[model samples]
Target: MQSVERTFELLELMADSGGEVALSDLAEQSGLPLPTIHRIIRTLVNNGYARQQPSRRYALGPRLIRLGETASRALGSWARPYLAELTEITGESANMAVLDGEQIVYVAQAPSPHSMRMFTEVGRRVDAHATAVGKAVLATMPADEVAQLLARTPMSPKTENTITTIESMHEELERIRARGYSIDDGEQEVGVRCFAVAVPGAPAGAAISISGPEARMTRISTDEVIPLMQRLASSLSAELSASA
Candidate 1:
């Protein structure tokens, strides 16, 4: 059990380091002894979970890609029913997205019944600073880390309402934290409004959202919509945790 935990710790630390690290750095970051780190890393290398790079740093092995892609597909598959239910209840498009590095990747979506509804296709990637689902999940991250992530992205405005500065993003995230949900307010698209809430206790940065035309997803309706999104997000969190 201890070895298993240590192995995961090393893997997580490697991931945080952008998929590669030196042995000494891993020891320092994980607070594990050099010998212990070496032993676990050796086993990982032997099994193709980690590899010694040409530069002598250890990198996450290519083999993990298959596992990650499979798990991502499974996660999307499991979350679709919940997204579909939310779409049915809210009469809007429902989406599930996860933070992948500095980008938010839409994984699953159920379209609204309205013919003129907003559509964010599955596998579409967008900057984290420009979307409600992005803000919802980023609001759950540490302030410094969020800043670092934003620094890496271009912060380009998708629409006039998109957040284009780190300071503004911080302010937006604070409001999202207080409200327990996020509003897009035509940020990602000129005429669309979006509402999102993080899936608590799921993966590091997972969120669910509903979107529609701004005229339909109005401020007056927000009072009702937010609660439904929050409740469904909570339900999803529980189901995901239980399945894990």
Candidate 2:
């Protein structure tokens, strides 16, 4: 196989194992020699395609987001137009995110004019238990994987409202899956609330959300947000599926 094919295969191998692989593990898994794997990994690392943690394990790095953004920008032009529409209609900050480990990384955002809403940069990451988009996407993963992630990361409360127990977070994900949405009831911050919908995609878990002052967001229940978000999620899913 060609070097590019090997590189792409390496990416897939790492991604499927949840983005953390040891050198020995990668060599074993990829059927490549250790020195060859080291060279490929070093090349991938230098090019921003992978990261080697202090423990000497490798994981998907910032390059994945670069690739995701490129795909999102190209595939989500229609979604962008609608995001502005949603913000206009709801008067809340609208955003999109995807799961990266146990965190939700915002990939796009359309904020409302409200002076006191959540402010998120394009690449901001937050604990899944503390935000709407995080819960929405986490609902789609296998129970064992979720357990493993939560096991490694303690449920530290971002605010008094954050879920601080694994059992509770699991329950929250269950609700997200069954109800087809998720809510952040002042979880990440003291006075902010958000509602999110899952946007199913391969190798990445994306979600769309609306967040703002709790007083205002609570004025509209999850029921009110569902139709618009479901519509958006459906469109996003279709876009990703077609691209795949």
Give the whole-model CA lDDT for all candidates, comma-separated. 0.88, 0.80
**Each model's TM-score, in the order given?**
0.88, 0.79
The list of candidate 1 runs beyond 4 A from truth reads: 52-54
Best by TM-score: 1
lDDT of 2 by residue, 1-244 (tens): 6888888878877876778889898788899888988888899999899999999899998978777768655544545665777798899989987776667777777879887777788778788778888888779889887887777677898888889888988888887788888888888888888888887663467788888888898788566668988887787778667866
Q: Residue-wise lDDT of candidate 1 within 143-177, one digit each (tens)? A: 99898778767899898888899999999999999
Q: List the residue pairs that clash in candidate 1.
A: none
The whole-model C-alpha lDDT of candidate 1 against the native structure comes to 0.88
